[model samples]
Target chain A: MEITPEKLRWIYTTMYRIRRFEEVLLEQTALGKSMGVAHTSDGEEAGPTGICAHLTDDDWIASTHRGHGHCIAKGVDTAGMMAEIFGKHTGLCKGKGGSMHIADFTKGMLGANGIVGAGIPLGVGAALSAKLKGDGSVGVSFFGDGATGEGTIHESMNLASVWKLPAIFVCENNHYAESTPVEYAVSVADIADRAASYSMPGVVVDGMDVFAVYDAAGEAIARARAGEGPTFLELKTYRYHGHFHADDPHTYRLPEEEELWKARDPLPNFERRVTEQDLMDDVEMERIRNEIDQEIQDAVKFAEESPLPPLEELYTDVYVNYSNPPQGLR
Target chain B: MTLDLRPDPLGPGFDVPGSEIRYREAFNRTLGDELRRDPDVFVMGEDVAGGAGREHLGIIDSWGGAFAATKGLIQEFGAERVRDTPISEAGFVGAAIGAALTGTRPVVDLMYFDFITVAWDQLLSNAAKNRYMFGGQGKIPITLFARSGVAAGYSAQHSQNFYSMVAHIPGLKCVAPSDAYTCRGLLAAAIRDDDPVIVCNHKKLINMSSFVPDESYTIELGKGRYLRRGSDVTLVGMSYTTEVCRLAAERLAEQGINAEVVDMLSLSPIDEDIVLESVTKTNRIVIVDEDTPRCNMASDIAALVADKAFDSLDAPVKRVTGPHTPVPYSKPLEDAFIPSPEDVVATTVALLGA
Candidate 1:
């Protein structure tokens, strides 16, 4: 498929937005402006941006704890997400879901789950819903290599294939499942290959290449939309930071491996690709970067200025219409 | 057939005419009826649509859930509404919770109650607590149906009854109907409830036929009923154990001991009034449970009676429960493990001093 200029710009802008958002998030965390443990998707941008490029706002996506990239790619409001991470009332989940649980159902961005591999089944369920409702919308479950070891992922894949549900399982194989390497936990060499066992197509894509992820995701999503069931896409990538922002004293990872992944950073590689092919002008790219930087800065400002959810809010949203007030509230 | 305002030991209402449908059939009917009644209601689970990808399907809903509860739903509702999930309990269960929060009432089948461990966090943390945690901002009207208890030789991993585990949680309501009548009514009520409900359908009760009302009905939560009222002793049971309690009551009757059999249908907000009433009348009590002895419903009820009706008791409350050991595969060992009608009778007789 030929890449259009508009699509290329969309991809670049999304990547830049996610990168700058995380950079600011890290800075905020360092400055004690944000509470809760935050995991930045700084290096794993290509997988989310590429996969989400094929999805409409109506198409649902379930993200992992390291989900800022997925949130941006799926078009969640940067200001709301930032405010959410800051535990402000203006946050996406109204400050209920923090860094690990940010969600925007309106955009079909299911909350970023704290549990590994927990989102796979939820995506399958959403796909099942779409298939049942004949909505033609597909559900995407994004998880790390660690999630592949979860039984739910395998079960979800099998069910999705058997029912021919409209869903895509995107395994962001970011080398580590927390401190443990993928090899130590996952028995299979290729996470995508496991999809074959479920009688579905499994594709291994370059997690670092936004275009490659887009191409693979496009085909899988189209197939799902065509009532062809689910696809498992293993985006071979690596994370540049420890599992979480709080994960300092990074003793588990080899410094050289971290350095190697840093060198293959998704944003710079996409920048070089777009500039080299003249798909985007350097000046325009710089303009987009500056624009995204300003947006992130504005979000940080909004979050910093935003008020924390009132103590009374802790009692709200527990039930849709609870007859009696919850025990604590009472 | 009238809605009894008296709130009997079993519950307030008498049996609705058609309340006796099999637990599995009632579930499917409830799904179909709810879906037809409300467009937002849908069903999703593993093999809920028995024959998803067969070459030439001869049978309908070949899987229909291991017990065929959801059979023929796909044909009526189509593949979209009657969704068949992969074995991803956490995924689909969590998704069902998400969908419930997003204006869809999803009835998710866990297949076996024990498999709930895989999706425990979602069911317990998210679905159960979401409403209370959100402080009433959200309502998760998700009904989780799972076949519980040791029956049909399915041992250990598949047989344990964890309803008490759910009952222990403040936000969740747990229901275990003794027969088809209660199953249908309770299921209908569960579908309409704003809170998350875990319906523990006994594996043995799937094929047990009962009279069911043609019209829709609902059995209220947190109620109990007197299956058989007597003056000598009060026997409390839940789920399959209700049958055992009835049989024990019958046996005790032969020995001139009139026993009151109480089916505590809802475990969470237990019908303390009925239990205390029965205890006050009989002045002697025996609690029968299919679950293991420790931290089970028997203990909960025993504790309740001791605290509230201690003066009314003629003797210490007797708990006839399944052994604490994991359910064994061997028929004899399994039979020995679970509380039997004879065991209930013996316990009641021992307490009553026949």
Candidate 2:
């Protein structure tokens, strides 16, 4: 894939932004600024940024609960997202959805789902709509290896393949699903091999390497847009934190495994690759990181200063024109 | 019998001068008309266009949907709009919700109301809460249809009135169309609605014919109308139970008793005003439901009246509903399971002390 100067900046910047954004958001959540649990996607930055790099606002992506990285990568406004997670009036979901349900329809980011495997079919439906409209837009579903056990994913993959819909199923295998290991749950050794059952091409990529994710995602996305049908991508990655804000990985996973994955962090890997290839200098990379660091601080301040949603807002936005409130809500 | 109403549903620019048709026909016609009206509207579900994608073998649309709700729709709208899906209930419903979220309107026929449990998570989590959770980013304008209530010996699973379950959620809109007229009006209203609306088509009422306007129109969502006017006692009904209330009212009239009937077209954003108004004037009510007792629609309406209309009620609010038991397969047992017109009359008589 051709990486222009501007494209290269965006790729690096997005990955860095995702990492910093999560680091800062975790701090805020720890401070009790957020109303609900915040599922930060720190170590899994490359999985979303690389895939989203090939997508535009017209294309759609459905995300899992660990979705903050996907939201940033999809170009959702961080201030609105921060405020939303902070439970402020100016938040993306008007303080209603908080962290788990942040979505911008205009941006084609089809919300971070609260349910485990629920977003799978939703993305496939968008692909179906795209096919019917004869539009070139492709829909992507970002899920974890744990979600493979869900019936919706399997059903959706078959539907997309039968209709030859433009959809990319990106399975980020983050080693663990909450407290359970993938080995104990999933029948197959590789999630990608299951794609064969649905008559679709499946590719496995290194989730820690931005280039690998970008390369695989670009080819899969191109194939979808060409009407060649859906592709299943299993991205081998890890999460720096627990399943949720309060979870502790010490109970389920070992420190050695954590150290092995963290050693190949996407941000450091990208910096080394670019410097060695003479694609970008260390100063330029540092400048981008500094800029993102400030952006994260500004987002935190905006969220802190924003007001909480009013009492009346509790009853609003349930339905577009439901003037006659449900008897109980009223 | 020529239907007569004090307010006159056919009065002054209302009720089109057209033909009488079965509730099923109205259902089938409205879908085709809606598909024609909007390019974005599409239908999907098991057997919605049953034999689709089999044009090579000279077979087409063998099932046309479960109750034949989309019987002629495929021929008019084509197979592209009329989608026949696998029996994966959760998958298709999620896809429908996704399609609705991104602009198009998807009308999904889930065959039986009993099967709603299979896809309950999708309906409850995604379709219902999409807009609310996203803080008004988009609307889930998906209309779901499922056959409800007891037809015969379909047994426990087939015959169920789970409207109260959907209505229990704050985000979804639930409706039960009573006859051809309501089936036509309510189905159209549900299609155009911006929120997720579940239209419960009762199995017993599908073949029943009533005067239906040929012209396209929508019955206002969350509104109920008086089927018959009387000052004595109010008989509240939903779906097929409304027919039971009407029949009981007719019988009561012959015995010098005046019973009013209220057909609740919508259940979620319930027509609280109409129910309150009827109860306040008549000072008595008998709510009829076909679902199993305990946290069902009958109990809900009873609670609503007791909470709001306590001062106006002269007699205790009684309920005539299916007993707390699964519908039996045997003829005699199934007959006993469903609340009949006689059941309504007996309950109303006891409530009135007459």
Candidate 3:
């Protein structure tokens, strides 16, 4: 697949946006401006940005707890997401769902579930609706390699294949399921190979190579839209940050292993390839980086100024109407 | 003007007349009517279409579901509206929630109420709590039809009634309609309700029949009905226990004691007004339930009466409930395990005497 100037620029900008967003969040955490746990998708940016580049806003996607990158790639408002993390009223879930549960239905981003592997069935449900409604829209579920062990993902895959629903199950194999390594937990050598048991196609891609992910996602998404059922794509990736901001790094992962992953950084590799091919110049790339930095700074300002949800909101949204309140309420 | 306390015989409110039609047929008729009236109402479940890929039988809509409650739905509505899923409980049930969130109102059959455990996360975590958890941003207008109550020989796994588990969860409305009329109206109400609801239909009540209105109607959630009025004591029953109450009321009448039978139709947001009023007038109460005694409806109602209307009570609240054991398979043991009409009469008489 030939990389056009516009497509290359989009990939570069999306990746940069995710990286800068996380960097701002990290800074905010250090300043004590944010509360609760947060997981940064710093090293896994290429998988979400590259794959989402091949999708339309009509296509539905479900994300994991480490989901800021996926939400940005899928076009969730950066201001709303930031305000949400700040516990402001202007948040994506109106201040109810924090970082882990942020959702924007209008953008077809279902949610980032706190429970591991819970979003798999939701994505399948979205695909089932599209199929039953006779729409060509596809659904995608993005989870870590850890989610492959969940029963819901297996059930969802079987159901999606049996019904011939339009769905793509993408596993961001970041080599770790929290503190545990994938090699110690997963029985299968490759998560994608498990897809064959459900009679669906599976592929593995170099998550560091944005072009590789885009090419694979394009084919999988096209097949889903063409009524070919579901596909499972495993993106081999890594996360630079610890599982969460609060986690102690000395307990599990080795410092040397982390350095190895950091050395093969996705951004530098992409820049080298694009520059070598004469796809873009360093000046244009630097300009894109500055633009993304400004966007992230503006988002932080918006979050800082946004109001917190009123105290009255605590009792509200418990039901459509309180006429027949649940037993506990009374 | 005063909330129309006088119950309309044809409306969804309590004090309405009972229908003689079977529970299965009542559900089928209600689904059929709702589909006909509203273009967006659809039905999906296992074997709901009877046979999908079988060529030799050449029979369409044959299975009609495990109990045949959805028998003629596909025939009338066609495949698009009446869908049969591949025994994937969590997937399809979650899909039903998603569809309801989007635009469609789907009636999902879990085959057996026990199977709902497999889909509990979606039902409880997602469907039941979505409205409140999302701060009321969305509504889950979905109805789940499930069969419950012991079927004599189905053994422990299939026979146990698990309505209490759902009733324990907030934001989920649970209904176990005793007969055909209540089933039809309640099922329709569930479909129309903006919140998630679970209708636990008794397997034994499926073939039982009663009189039903020719027009569509809905029985509001949280309302209880006075199935039989009396002055001696109030015998509260729900689902299959309604039959036990009726028989026990007859036996109590023979001994010159008038017993008022109140069907606690809606379990979650129970009709406290009706129950308190009945208990105040009678000054005696006997709560009958088919589920085990511990933490079941019997104890729940007992606590409600004790907390709200303790002074009005003439005696300690009595409970006639299933034994504290799993539903037995043997006929005699199962018969002994479940609360009997005799136990209802004896308990009511004893409470009144005390």
Candidate 3 residue A91 C-alpha distance from true site, Å: 1.3
Q: Where is the poorest 10-residue window by lDDT in model 2 chain A?
A: A321-330
Interface RMSD of 3: 2.1
**lDDT value for candidate 1?**
0.81
Q: Model 1 chain B — which ten-residue stretch has the worst lDDT? A: B1-10
lDDT of each: 0.81, 0.89, 0.83
Candidate 1 docking quality: incorrect, acceptable, medium or high: acceptable
Best by lDDT: 2
Pairs in clash, predicted candidate 2: none
TM-scores, one per candidate: 0.85, 0.98, 0.94
Candidate 1, residue B172: how far the Cα is off, in Å: 4.3
lDDT of 2 by residue, A1-330 (tens): 788878889989999999888888888888988888998889999999899999999999999998899999999988899999999999999999989999998889999998999999999989988887888999899899889999999999988888888999999999898889999999988899999999999998999998999999999999999999999999999999998888888999999999999999998898898899999999999899899999989999999999999888887888887847543544
Encode model 1's per-residue lDDT on A1-330: one tens digit a residue: 688899999999998898888888988998987878899888888999998888888888888889889999999889988998888888877787788887777787876877777767778767766865677888898998988877778777776776687889999998888888888898888888888899999999999988889899999999999987888899999877678887852688878877887888888898898888888888999999989988988999999899998887766665444333555222
Output the number of the DockQ-best candidate: 2
Candidate 3: deviation at residue B349, Å?
Answer: 0.9
